[model samples]
Target chain A: PSSGIEKPTVKRFESYKRDSQLPQAIGELRILVDYRAQSIILPIFGRPVPFHISTLKNASKNDEGNFVYLRLNFVSPGQIGGKKDELPFEDPNAQFIRSFTFRSSNNSRMSQVFKDIQDMKKAATKRETERKEFAD
Target chain B: MAAKTVQYDNIYLNLSEKPGKLRIAPSGLGWKSPSLAEPFTLPISEIRRFCWSRFARGYELKIILKSKDPVSLDGFSQEDLDDLINVIKQNFDMGIEQKEFSIKGWNWGEANFLGSELVFDVNSRPAFEIPISAVTNTNLSGKNEVALEFSTTDDKQIPSAQVDELVEMRLYVPGTTAKEDAADGEE
Candidate 1:
């Protein structure tokens, strides 16, 4: 245990970046928000996909204020698909950052939902710290 | 026979409890909200937990999924909420554990119920999820927030992600949606 190296603190957000294109059909899709659950339920074709609120980096209304866009960043593997820098969508540890835009005719309903999420974001961070303290 | 349907209008938008039918049958439960392009359905087996609480305006029916976050629907009379609970109990084996709670003004910030796990996130800290079973007890102080006590003897860890897949199911509460629409009109 004599030879040791200290671990790094404060991970840089840029290192988590990964490239992936959103499908064309994503524009029409609706993401279900379980406000109490603090997760975004993505309505894929066959079934819905639920991602934790922690995975989301930022969420806001798109330009023209008619839609809501979300930025989700999650870690993935470093090497996949025989490519060094690309995220293969199947990488479990790759930091995939994808932005999703949802269009709704009723802008206000969408805005309120987004607002609720904004509030939830602050609350989620608080919970995270509490657990970290307990874990330590 | 056709499924029994309960339709309500101007329910909370968050609950997806629009002026549509909440159809409950032997197969499962489904709701068609005005905002959604299509109806969502959930099979009986996937439900993990359920809770009913009285909000400022009316009753809220919260349904937690085994693989997804919990959802709540508002805009129900107490009698109808009771009836819906009875119908679900009599027909389906939802595998849900019920709890008595009333969320007073978002005190604990959004606590996400994912199956047996509960996740909460606050400022400047990482989010974490712990199993509900691991939680020994919960106390509600006068400050309008819940204090959960967990046993550290077992060293339980929080899950980083949720399980796969979600069955389509929809519900809505009219309370918040109406206010949001009014705000839009004023602006």
Candidate 2:
């Protein structure tokens, strides 16, 4: 009887936009923690946006009333700190990918999401260690 | 020592470039725009990191310098992009070597990029490999950040003196380290 039953669909983390507005840089997204790929996938407007586990530098959460605010450090390779170009031109920072804060429905759900992120980071580190061991 | 030049539009999200030049020199990279008075020259040593990214029109080459802001060269034909990466890779190869200790004290002993692992041989010490993914960033300019941080790896830390030597070898951008040399010299 158990073999005849179909498996339940895997539920990815979905954001609740009741009181808080989403950031313009990152529009509506359905976040999925992909352990195999070692990345977090956010399908934004039909496009699958992926953030590698390594780029996630920091993560923190604050629970207030019925909601939890999750703060994420999105570190990009582009933010370099330097002076303006000699000819009065624009100089963009290299290592300063902005930290994003989003509202989730409850502490339980937000904690689960944070745990998933932590898991991905650990998995990435583990993979690197394995590669190094093999090379050695 | 070949000097190859390619021209493309430097596309920004809300802006356009009217045929910019990318000159590949043996020692470094040169980029110039029509509005700029002088062509920007970035020695290979100054380039902290570089990567490719997809853009709305085509692809963009992002270069992060140690002492400067990140620059994006956009709208490249696929062929041109291939050529650019090849040239840069060649330059990078020249910088890497086995058993090289050009700098004082700290010894590279033998280091090679084997696949994605940066395998290192430090003289009598056991050789170790560091996965490229473990590196969060590089210090090209030797100013704010250390030249290389092994904290990304789970391995035991080398003596602080050795770490300093590695920084001197990998991160020193010719002139900036002079300011900190006195303090570093004390140790």
DockQ of candidate 1 relative to the true structure:
0.02
lDDT of each: 0.42, 0.43
Candidate 2 lDDT by residue in tens digits, A1-136: 2366544332222222111222222222234565644555442111223445654656777777865666665443223542232111111222222343455555675688789998777776687677546744
Per-candidate TM equals: 0.32, 0.30
- Write down the worst ten-residue block by lDDT for model 1 chain A: A12-21
Per-residue lDDT over A89-132 for candidate 1, one digit per residue giving the tens place of the 0 to 100 score: 32232112233334444566567667767777778778767755
Q: What is candidate 1's local distance difference test score?
A: 0.42
lDDT of 1 at B121: 31
Candidate 2 lDDT over B47-140, as tens digits, reads 7666554332344565655554345455554456566666666665432111211111121234445444454433332133344444555554
Q: Please tell me what DockQ candidate 2 reaches.
A: 0.03
TM-scores of chain A across candidates: 0.52, 0.54
